[model samples]
Target: MKTNSLLLYSCLLTMAACAGKNNVPATETINALNLKKGKTIFCGPADKQLGAVSFKISGNGKVQEDFNMALAMLHSFEYDEAEKAFADVIRKEPGCAMAYWGVAMSNFHPLWSPPSKEEFDKGVKAVAIAKSIGKKSKKETAYIDAIGAFYDVNAKDHRARCINFEKAMEKLHLDYPDDQDAATFYALALNSAADPADKTHAKQRKAGELLAKLGFDKSFHPGVIHYIIHSYDYPELAERALPAARKYASVAPSSAHAQHMPSHIFVRLGLWDESIYSNTIAADAARCYAENAGIKGHWDEELHSLDYLVYSYLQKADNKRAKQLCDYLNTIREVHPVTPKVLYSFAAIPARYVLENRMWKEAAVLEAHAAGNDWKKFPWENAIIHFTRLLGAVNLNQLDAARTELKTLTALHDELIQKQEAYKANQVQIQVKASEAWILFKEGKHEEALKQMNLAATMEESTPKPPVTPGEVAPARELLGDMLLAMNRPAEALEAYASNLKDRPNRFNALYNAGLAAERSNNAGKAADYYRRLLASSNAPGADRPELTAARLFLEKQKTLAVR
Candidate 1:
């Protein structure tokens, strides 16, 4: 049956491409490929243009029904809920081998946090239990084997194990050509194994293409859409993901993360208004969920939403709303005990508020010792707090204080390295270098300062900024622009700001500073253009930005002078 279906689909594809249309409708194709469990079938649609994969399983009615529910949650990355649903299936049919597979799969979060030793052991034990059931289908055995590879304690490297699991899934997908879930998970595993530093993003793009075949048919599948968004998250590919990003929240409106996910593309595209709407809805929903669960402090979901919301507000010069969010975050510390996760957001809120608003004076005055409890436990989170303080000291010419903060950042970087957190260690190292460049400029070392700043910028360009924040504390090139302006080099400063804007677009400080730089360089027309864009982005009411007032006055004067 599977072989025949493939031949039929290949003919249809040839006909569609050569003749401009396949006489068979997509609905008919789906109907033809809907084979029962015992029959082999094609994994994905034979017609590449048609984006649906409908694979079904047959078993005891109640157990099969519950297993389907668990699978849906697993596809969407909802591990906790999936675990419960799969456990219910095991309870209903203790001998069901695939139910144990579901439990093991739920225990692994491919990209975010690696499973703990205990989690890996539990998943391995589950696979062992599934093997003991003896009545498992070939497809079930394939899944069990793939998870066994994932928990291979001897492999030691988590990423290498993930790649092994991906390879296993690829073979399973090919062997069971009719299993849509296998194909879907294979694409997900491809992304899980992708290295973000790879500029080609080869695996991510492949994952996106494979998932794209599911198109409108599986539009309601949260994992299909969610994975699509993640696959094309880079600035270069963000345009390609606009459709999926727009549709995901509506597809999974009940999901807090889903509501927030689209904003990733929105932020990349500089669609401030869309980002604002998405995060607002997400934050509200997350708050409701936290209250219902009797959780005092914000959970991970709520913190994620609030972080994005505050960022969007600052981007649009909605300082009032941003301040309100900061106030809300303050309440979080008062209500809940400090966990590492909550501490991350608690540190981020204040840092974002000051930095995004360009409140350099406030940052300068911020006390480093006021850092949240157990700050040392999470050096990566504490680094952001210290970064802002470093920037503030530089801006105020508090050289000694800035040097002290830079030492703190170095300490944090070394600590992260010792803990095997390579990515964050490098991020903090970049901060330290950028601060050093600032100090060089303060010392009137012009040539040395620019060289250090450029080197810092190059290092920054080598890696993408972590997505957890709306923007960097101070983009390296943007700091270079600040140094250029300090040296009375307006034209050169404008060019530097423009370069930074290419990667981090529509940023408030960059936009406003660009305008200032333009005006100082005697380019009235370009200066006016920059100010207009800045004003357009400033949609918040009662926003107290003096720069906003300056831009308004400058633009108005330009208009009056033009009338002369």
Candidate 2:
């Protein structure tokens, strides 16, 4: 396999050289010949296939291939492995300034969360070491300086530093227009600095356009394809990224993150089977990598992929698989180097299991801080636990318990606001208002309850989901439909569910309940149509979710009526 890969890489390089002589773009020529699926020529460890990446730098001549492999790992967001690869390069040649730069880059995850204090200090120290080595070419210096901006001590915060870093990368990209590394990293910086509230997706669109110029369809560079997926992760832009999403895993199948990243688009498009396939491989890959590396506990990537897997399963009405995942989650006693991603996944998986299944009593009893992680570090994640519990309490008419959960949610909301996490704070506020509305309905304040619920739904509809989560624990609009249904307003309930389904398609609860609402409104035809959709989307053999059963019975009854 290695020999074959090397031969393919040689052929590609030869083709590019020939194309350059003929004044033709190499990527376009390669695309024309349909040779775009070739693997990276440079070999790293047997298990780490991080697509083609080459960034020439002033490094030990023998370590250049290793350096490129490290850069590829970094592009795939396999930070731990990338850091080790870079460190190995430094051991081989301590004067390799670019190797030190890779170490610094590994510590700064652009899209996930800001570095911890320890990570920040490590990045700063690595940058200092690279600067002290100080014999880099102009291009290498530009790369170092761009990353250094993110570690600037005088910057107000991570966000401010992100903007500074983006500006620096923009300059570097402009200076080296022919450099694929510069363009790919610059596109990533643009996405990292994007404002989530900017519904126009201006930064995202710019990033996507920049990636497109790199011949995204034909380039085997993992970063090019990976960043393209992220650049188009938004609902409005998801379809544009479908091709990249479908192609990324094949390009770098050995990277766990590469396997998982495609599901971001899959989930957005409500492609449950595709998402399940992606994350299933990703989770297993993560586990295998950890075990092979002799790591004692789960990697955060494993948990992250599992969360996506569980979510997709629930959406497909594959409750048996979803339950098995929840069981698997419970067996995990530890995750190595617990980051925000790990915490969010640990908290979210169970919350999603209960809420998605509508196991109201189970949700009511769900414990917070159960993972033994520091919940205070992530108020948004903590709020998910409380919000799920609140929903359960409200549904079960446990008014006092619902109010208690609401109070805790309000406190978390205030905490997020104080931290200047406006997006998360707004999300928590929606939960608070929804919980309050449900509690009011239980108290017989029907008009007031409906009004408050509507406002919450609107607020939620305006807020796009963060990239970290599969979806909200319970979407506020769906909750509004539930409230309307409970109030015996089936027509209004159907409208609410229909609108929510447009944004979040193929949801089991929404589909089943939408059908129920249609039936209650005396629209048997519409109800049957919804039931058929539900059945078609969820064909898990022998899977018997009550909702699926209800849908089946409804359809059968309709068929009988037609025969009569």
The numbered model that scores best in lDDT is 2
Per-candidate TM-scores read: 0.86, 0.89
lDDT of each: 0.73, 0.83
Which consecutive 10 residues in model 1 have the weakest lDDT in total? Answer: 35-44
lDDT of 1 by residue, 1-564 (tens): 224433443554443234223211233322232211211111122321112224343355667656776676676565666677676766566566677677778888886667765566556556555555556567777888887777665565789889988899889888976666776788888988888688888998998898888663346666787888888888778888889889877666655667788998898877889998998887786676556555665556677677777878887888888888888776555334343445567677788788776678888765433435667788888887888888888888889999998898999999999999898888888888888888888999988989888888888877765666655656888988888988999999999998887877788888899999999999998898888888888767777788899999998898898899
Estimate candidate 1's alpha-carbon lDDT, on a 0 to 1 scale. Answer: 0.73
lDDT of 2 by residue, 408-483 (tens): 9999999999999898899899988898899999999999999999999999877778778888878899999999
Candidate 2: stretches off by over 4 Å = 1-47
Backbone clashes per model, in order? 5, 0
lDDT of 2 at 148: 85
